[model samples]
Target: MKLLFSLTSLFLLICSTALAYDNEPNGFKGLKWGTSIEEFKNVYPNATLQKQQPGEYNPANIITYIVPINESKLSGITITSPFRYSFYNNKLESVLVTFTGKDNYETLNKQKILLNRMSMIYGEINESSGNNIDEFIPGLSTSYYNFNYCWKGTTTTINLNGSYKEPNLSSYLSISISSVEIRKQWLSKVKPIDKTEWSKIRKNIISEYRSDW
Candidate 1:
């Protein structure tokens, strides 16, 4: 009985430690994608963001933020944009940025400003739901764009696309930025779910929303 009790206690301790590390801020807890507007707000309270109403070109909500993590130590940042309708179909767009050494902030800031500008470009269209925005701006393609970010040996690329739409013409954007080194170190120390697991979590959230609608 004594040996069994000791083993049970040890197991509980390990479980508790794992849960603590998993829920830590700036950890993987913050790197989720495809989450709803409400869920995103819960995680990023400091983002001070806003959502636009549906219109001719505008989808639904526009979420923008300057990541709260220490940019200097980050390995990369990824932004995932997913659009779902009252129907069951799901559309996803992703972008990545990798940065290292000096000028990291410059590159990161540039990306940030670009996102903000993009938001403004579509701001009116987003407000009107694509009605007011001109269909042909010379080389312009679509109105919606998705992207991601990461850090490599001082070089980074912000991938983007203008394809995605919501049922009510309302769309969703989820951004996640992290340092590769920090993520690996923390994950190595804790027993959190891997990327596959995290992806499931995101999918489940989307599924739940779909079911509710």
Candidate 2:
């Protein structure tokens, strides 16, 4: 009975996690990941792909687009911003959206709306807060916070971050959604350290022999 109960619990946990990611979000703006550059161009015929890094980099290609600011034109979406897409292995890996404008109550409200929209699709989010300052400019501090949401099925992560300076004059928000598998595959290709070899080196000791001449 105990084993059966444990099995049942495991099944329930798996099901709950699966249900959390009912919508398998791949890309934004009608674009999906794992699509080749040619395929992307077919969708957005005039879209241009810019190479930001060397071919060795995981995200070697990028495309930035400006979204319309007219709320009604965007169908009641006021949080219009530019989106940057990072492509790896000829496939889209991450999408970063930047919300611009002076930091104020209005900006915060828009951010809240964006978060709500994302939550509806990505599920509950894990929120966090932090502080950031310009190292060169002293006394220039800002409040920085972010909401991170993840899905188990696709191992995708979505991060919504906001930063604002004092007096709410300068503020901006950024949203990033990335695929975990793509990141892991790319990161693994970077310079990797051999822990076992490092440990051996750390334990190696030179014998001290006093030579009396």
Candidate 3:
């Protein structure tokens, strides 16, 4: 299940599509895609550098910064999550906002709330869903499930993704926003990735759970 989930996420990272939707989100906060990292720091002085790590699909390392503004309203629902901005080649390439709850039910409920809001705003441009159930032991079962809704604009793509695992009852929910157009530009200028960098640049999604949990 872990291997399958990772592969699917990797494919989606490379296959981000542009759409004609006018209401889709194209940037993070008020910053536009491809904004310089220095300028980003100027606009967000309180943002702290998380790491300068290899991006999932880029040859060089990408820098990540985390800000304090964590609560956001999805239409009427209030969601609290850690938000990170990532830059590749000194330009903003992606933003990730994630929320994970202690238990499955609470996380799933929040996922539904956010999904409803996304549907209202983005109109559900795409859907990706799959699951695997395994009877690991006698009278015991293990399962992994994934469901994601996507929307795209002229330059960006957004995905509201949810994943649940049985036995552990752990859940992960995220709002992943990427500059699909800028990513393409970056891809054009970078060197071809070798085996070592390819392994180093594996997708590193940092998911933060609720503190109250």
Maximum-lDDT candidate: 3
Q: Model 2, range 79-190, lDDT digits (tens) per residue?
A: 5454456667777666666554444455555566766786677566543334322121212434423222334444555555554444454455556666666655655554
Which candidate do you rate higher for TM-score, 1 or 2? 2
Can you write out model 3's per-residue Cα lDDT over 1-213, one digit (the tens) per residue? 233234344544554665646476658789898899889989988889874322334344567798775566555555555577888878898887766655666666777778777777777566455542121221133676676777766678887776776654456667778888777776677676566765654433222122211
Q: Report each candidate's C-alpha RMSD, comma-separated, in the order given.
A: 19.8, 15.8, 6.1
159: Cα error in model 3, Å: 0.8
Candidates 1 and 2 compared by lDDT, better number: 2
Query: lDDT for model 1, on a 0 to 1 scale?
Result: 0.28
- Pitting candidate 2 against candidate 3, the one with the higher TM-score is 3
Name model 2 segments beyond 4 Å from true: 1-22, 50-76, 126-155, 191-213
Tell me the whole-model lDDT of each prediction, alpha carbons only.
0.28, 0.46, 0.64
Per-candidate count of clashing residue pairs (backbone under 3 Å): 35, 0, 0
What is the model-wide C-alpha lDDT for candidate 2?
Answer: 0.46
**TM-score ranking, high to low:** 3, 2, 1
After TM-score superposition, the amount by which residue 41's alpha carbon in candidate 3 deviates from its true location, in angstroms, is 1.3
Tell me the lDDT of model 1 at 76: 37
